[model samples]
Target chain A: MSALLLHALGIVLVTAAMTFVTRSAPFVLFGKKRGTPPIVLFLGTYLPPAILAMLVVYGLKDVRLLAYPYGLPELIGVATVVGLHVWKRNYLLSIFVGTAAYMVAVQWVFQGTL
Target chain B: MMKTVRAAFLTTLPVMTGYLAVGVAFGLLLQKSGYGVAWAALSSVLVYAGSMQFVLVGLLADGSGFVAVAMVTLFVNLRHFFYGLSFIDTFRAMGRRRPYMIFALTDETYSILCTAKPPEDVDGKAYFFWIALLDQSYWVAGSIAGSLAGSLIPFDMTGLGFAMTALFLVLLVEQWEAFRTHEPVFVGLASALGAVLVFGRGNLLLPALVTIVVVLLLMKKRLTREAYAPPTPPAPADGPEAGGAP
Candidate 1:
């Protein structure tokens, strides 16, 4: 309707299209083959853990190590997560507690200090 | 089908919590940025990538050029290319659901799909599809709710987004336990940390992923051997038969 909405729609479309391209490129490249290569299979099996590890890092990439709070909240939060997960081995419990710890650390414990 | 959906729902519960928190945050931000429920819903349903949607709100607010938007989107989402590598054959087997399976492969969905195997009696394809669908539905529902509640809500949700980080960490630990060796995990952590140190946070993902692939390629022989190696026999006296058993 309006120019702004039109522009926003264009941005959304482009963003969606580019995102889809990235997600589907691997399939499109390897899909037509009769059998998957051993290398691809190797990557499929092993790459996930590495990717998950990378994602953990990616998630914490924004934490500032040099600043006042100095990434303490994230450290404590992650420690809680790892500790709870290791000790209890409960998925939901670990995530909920870890997240709550993080929220408290940022919201109250380190509030206005960042 | 109902069984598949129920199982998928249970499997995606963690994702549900994380997505709703982050999705509501996204919706709130978009609404605060002058776009309302309709825009929030559209983007959540169409784009569906969590972090990218958050970034999109800023781009929309600034009225950034399509070229710039596209470039930013590509850079932010390049890691997704590798995600599909893990699912190519599995998704191919899904037949008619293959395209949606690919399209809905968000980080959370990908992570859950990587580990959440269906029960023996349940249909694996249906399970996977429901997980993907249910995850997206949570995201969409959260977006709409946030947009609707943004104006009325006057509360602080500063770090609820950490649920996502916690989700990843939990999954990482699970993956660590599932694998026989932790080489891939270490490789990932080292490569990503190296990239962060060298490239800085915003630019680390591509380099980190590239380094990971290269390093894993080099370590292929050892890693594959470890991954596929049969369990060792307790006693050496039975070693010959053990070695030839498979």
Candidate 2:
């Protein structure tokens, strides 16, 4: 088999394994009989927002502040997303407008520079 | 079972809207990255993680080592570790369907299950199973459609990837409105900022998540109790407890 295909297979397996491990950890460690420990409950209830916030940062990790564009496209794009979401309370509108704004900024306004 | 499935489908309608947009973006990006529809559909079937799949594209394009990719996958989906905690009992009772239920516990599915209430006469496990199955089907279908469109269209979709970010932000705002305590959000933001300063952008996520988990663990006493505390009941209008006529 080709190396690229091998890599793809490896990726699929590794990712699937990782997902299984993560999802089943609480179950494996605590088992079915034991009540979910307080700590686990605490983390379960609170971790969603924390992880969501981290994902936002992760999503923006590639934008370079030191570069010529200075992350303006990202900032404006996020602002559009936040503004539209808060106002219209429509997820589709917010994501569509935000993504379009970012695409326009990067493809046109910030086209010349990296 | 059909009624349960219908209700589950109804509950998953909102996620369908979100998943279609993001899943299409994933497909388009994957096609642009030089992968074909088979790879797109395969990943959606096997990995089934929207955010991590985006990261996976970058990793695959770079031809990164297996070890590095595996580590990144673990770190990216670390949050799924906790998603299953609350559902342990619910899923354990699912008999033959237990494994698939566990496998399909994506963030969106978890959210729907957390709030889902099967009609009184319906089987709860069946309802949960249908929700998960329907949600996964929507994602898989969206991704396949996206890949087909990406291959057919010649349009440049620069900046469209922000849909995932926008999705996360919208979910964050909704969580913020629902929860009384904002400590976890602050912990996440601060930890991420600190990680960025220490580890740089490319390597920030793992450390930031580690730090947030640690901080939350340390402050578990205060956070767990208040974060999900049920609202206090109102006083009776004409009782001694109320400042009204007795």
Best-performing candidate as measured by lDDT: 1
TM-scores for all candidates: the values are 0.89, 0.72
Worst 10 residues of 2 chain B by lDDT: B237-246
DockQ values per model: 0.59, 0.44
Q: List the residue pairs that clash in candidate 2.
A: none
- Summarize candidate 2's per-residue lDDT along B1-246 as a digit string, tens digits: 778888778767657866776788888899888888898899999888878899988987888888888888888888777677656656666778888988898877875665455777777778878889998998898888889984565666566566667667776776666667788888988898899989998778678868988998897777646345531111111211211110
lDDT of 1 by residue, B38-140 (tens): 9999998889899899899999999999999999999999889988877766777778998998999999998877777577778777888899999999999
Off by over 4 Å in 1: B226-246
Location of the lowest summed lDDT over 10 successive residues in candidate 1 chain A:
A34-43
Candidate 1: the clashing residue pairs are none
Q: Which lDDT values do the candidates have, in the order given?
A: 0.84, 0.75
Given the true complex, what DockQ would model 1 score? 0.59
User: What is the two-chain DockQ of model 2?
Assistant: 0.44
Tens digits of lDDT, candidate 1, A4-107:
88998999999999989889999989877877666776777778899889989988999988987999999999999999999998888999999899989999
